[model samples]
Target: MLDPKLMDEPARIAALDRYDVLDTPREPGFDRITNLVRSILGVPISAISLLDRDRQWFKSLNGLDASETPRDIAFCDYTIRQRAPMIVTDAHADARFCDNPYVIGDPNIRSYAGIPLETPDGYNIGSLCAIDIVPRQFDPGQIAILQNLAALVVEQLELRRIAERDHLTGALTRRAFLGEMNRAIALFERHQRPASLLLFDIDHFKQINDNHGHPAGDQVIRGIARLCTGLQRPSDSLGRLGGEEFGILLPETGQEDAARAAQRFCETIAATEIPGTPPLRVTVSFGVAELRSDWPTCESWLAVADMALYEAKRSGRNRVAIARHDASHAT
Candidate 1:
């Protein structure tokens, strides 16, 4: 039976989601820690595991063949539910894991030690675990080392979260946005998946800053970001591409769908009254560009979208423009 705490909780799930590390490619920063842990602990397998809604995903698996396992059967699940490290000397003697598939079948986990990867706000998002195929007791000094290593994992997560987001609007920073775009481009190149980019900026943003104080301008920026986030799908990524300009990367979407989304954002901004002392109103222009197979780089893809944005501003602000195959624009 699963622990009661393992049941889905909105706040816990949200806390895990904030790190945005699930399903991401392995990085050396995490891989190094897992490798070091496995070597130092003399364990065959070491993994940086994140407990998601239904599965335990491994950010870095040193010796495991599988990347994830069901949450109900995950040892890391039990580890994350407590503050202290969980050390099991023998899985066969433990009723909780005696019948577990991993214990009964391949990899036959006999000994396990895990430390909860607790966030700064006191949430245990996941665990750093070391697994041995043979039964062995983990000494107090070994547990302490594992606990210290887990802290480093948490620090890495915090650093990544800080580096990826814009300070004011809470959107992806320009560098991070482009990095995601590059990843999307690689995915498209590998699997021929559809993706699109929507670049937009506030109309007469300078005038707003000129009329109202800088604080009001900041509020407007935050408001626009919130609106865009609310309108976007979970797969879509919104990024603050400097100043009043923002970009949204829509995976598994085409040019038409991206243009429609941009149109919705454009209309919404024009209609909604931003909260302020005077309750300011604003409008925005948008440019949509679909990822093409022939594009050489992410910058080329961005250049097309930027051209479309220039066309929108040139024709008239507060409208959506799409980039075509021939470098022509359609509004």
Candidate 2:
């Protein structure tokens, strides 16, 4: 049995969450790593593993049939605990794993070598390992190669974070958000499926910073970003357009649906309480525009949405307004 203290659940889990890699679509970088491992080491199976709360999930697998299994039953779980690489040249002879279910059951591992995949901040999120059905010694040269490969995998994950995520808030950054909007536009053009854009900004944000301080204003921004993000479906993309402003791209959504979603965001933001903050609440204004062929490009569509947002601000804050494009094309 593994000692609970060996795994710092909170730090490790937080580190894992920061990458945002769990259950995401498989990428070429990881697949390439596992394939190289299998080829270079002459191993039957190789995988990049990530530890979630209870499961050891395979981010990449070559010659492995399973996607995930119990963390207690995973070799990578034990490997992640070690600062140095873990090698079990003969599983059946090792006291730590001799009677382990995996060794005695399916997969029937005989030898294994794992290099811990450490985050830049030094959290061991998981491991990159090669498995063999027959016992074999893992030389220092081979172990070094595994270490380098593990670093490459972590590098790829970090690159994804820089490209897709905003540092202050967990929302997508402006450029990345626009890329998502463009992709949605391409899909709409191909299939003529309904889609919409929602642009919004916090009301009286300067006042919050003046009265409560910039830190409180930052907390408020993060709170609202999470609020809008949590309300959307997986297909939707929410982004921090700029300070105190955010945009959402809703795929397969029409004008009415977009309006309702914007309303929910407005109401939710108004009613929610910011934890560990001073006695202050915030409100937001929203503008929605459904996809239209006449709008053509993503920028053009966003311009229309921005116009609607201007209208919302012109009338009053804390309300949802629809764009002329959506109103004209309402179906």
Candidate 3:
């Protein structure tokens, strides 16, 4: 079995998530580095691999047709464990890899080298790797070049993260979230495909901090972030929108479906315990709004949702409210 300890570390996994690079579209910066690794090492295949819980996903691939593979048979998994350059001189002669399915069949990797990609906070997220079908020795000088390329990958990841992520909850920031919402809105305009917005506010959140402490309050915030993230679809996005509030952008989702999702969140939030608190459970009020052909602008989309959220807050506390055409005009 693969090293269970390295694969299960939450801090390292979370560090990988903070980069927000997994399953994201290819970019030239990462592509260029993979290209450089291929050239520098004279390998047939190269990739920028990001490790997730069950799979090693490639953010950039050159000379490889596949996008991902299971973690158990992944050479990159071993590379991530040591956070160093891991070179398998000859997979056919090595006990650890000789019978591996990948080597025995397609891609037929015989020699492999992976340089670990590190976050600034010191977690090794994944690797920049070079693979060849023929066994060979790795020159020390070539390995140094591969390490430098790995550094460039890290630099790009950190830059993308700072610009796109919220520092507190590990969700997208308000600006970034709305930026995506705007694109969904444009898609709605051109294609008439429906998208829904869910805005939720923690019920009685001030008491979390007042009764416990600021540290406890922060734990609650992070917990809510995790809960909402677990409830979202692959294409859906969850984001922290200022204090005590979060936004979910659900493209190709309708109002009723969004409400069902919000209800799930309400139930989950109430049942969840804050990591640092003995009895602190959170309840949230939701404002769900779907795009309307009659709506004038993107600003109106949020306005409608915010008004629904206000109604949810006013009606009781921990319930969901939907925005309708008539409701949009209501004070």
Candidate 4:
């Protein structure tokens, strides 16, 4: 039996949650590494394994035939539990693995070498492992090289996490938002199809700071953030540029669809009534901008949307404003 201290199932689950990499498709970089392992080690099976609650999932595999297998039958499970490299020269002879299904059954592992995949926090999530049907040995130098390769996998995962999140709203940040927006725009640009941007401002935000205090203001901000999260499409991104201002990147949507979405969001806020001691009410104004070929840069496209937003605030508070291009001018 595995020691409780060596493999805390609950702790491992929590570490996997932080990376948010479960069930994700095989990434090219990880696939390349596994391919290299198979070539160098001359193994019929090489895998980048991620330890799940009850299973070890192969994110990338060179010669493995299954997507996943029970963790109890996984050599990587034991490898993840170890601080140093785990080497089993002959699984049928080792007490820990002799009865294991992999050793006795299909794949019939005769030799295995596993290097634990670790997070920056030192939690071992799984292993980069190679398996062979015939017994073989790895030199000490070879073990060190495999460990370094696993470190590179961790580095890539960290970089991806940093790219997609907004620091303030905990939503998709601006860079990721715009990148998706550009992809959508390119698909619709040929037809001159358009989308809309909803620019929302927390009405009299400074007054909230002045009257109730900044702490209260912060609460309101968080309240608004909660309302907006998951409010838009999985493709659409909601973000906070700065201060009380926020924007949504809508894709493949016209002005009418944007207006309807904005209206529904406004009504949702009214019914919820953001948190406050005196039961304070909050409202947001929206600005809709249609995509145009004349606006070559994302900055210029956003400028038109911001202009429309300024108009919404100018006309009155808490209303949606539609963008109208000047026919006389190019855009």
Whose TM-score is greatest here? 1
Per-residue lDDT for 231-320 in model 1, tens only? 999999999999999999999999888888999999999999999866899999998989996554777888888888988999998999
lDDT of 4 by residue, 127-239 (tens): 99888898788888778878888888788778866866766568666665565456456556656656667777777789988998877877777777788774778656687
Where model 1 places Cα greater than 4 Å from the true spot, the runs are 1-8, 175-196, 202-223, 226-236, 250-254, 268-283, 290-304, 310-317, 325-331
C-alpha lDDT of candidate 2 relative to the true structure: 0.87
* Superior candidate under TM-score, 1 versus 2: 1
Segments of candidate 4 deviating more than 4 angstroms: 1-7, 173-226, 229-331
| lDDT digits (tens) for residues 1-331 of candidate 2 | 6545346779889889877666655678889999999999999999999999999999898997877889888898889887789999999999988998889987889999999998887788999999999999999999999999999999988997888888889799887787677767767877777889999999999999998899999989888877777788987888998899899988889999899999998998899987647845789999998888878777788888888988899998899999985543432
- Give the Å error, residue 239, model 3: 5.9
For residues 1-331, what per-residue lDDT tens digits would candidate 3 score against the true structure?
A: 5545455569889888766566555778889998988887889899999888899999999998987899889888888888669999999999989999999999899999899887787777889999999999999998999998899999898787787878778899887787677767777877888999999989988987898888887888888998888878888988898888889999899999999998988888888876765657778999999888656465778888999999899999899999877755753
Sort all candidates by lDDT, best to worst.
1, 2, 3, 4
What lDDT does the true structure give each of the candidates?
0.89, 0.87, 0.85, 0.77
Top-scoring candidate (lDDT): 1
Ranking by TM-score: 1, 2, 3, 4
Better of 2 and 4 by TM-score: 2
By lDDT, the better pick of 1 and 4 is 1
How far does residue 178 in candidate 3 sit from its true spot (Å)? 8.5
Q: Please give each candidate's TM-score.
A: 0.75, 0.60, 0.59, 0.57
| Model 1 accuracy (lDDT, Cα) | 0.89
Model 3 / residue 90 / CA error / Å: 1.2
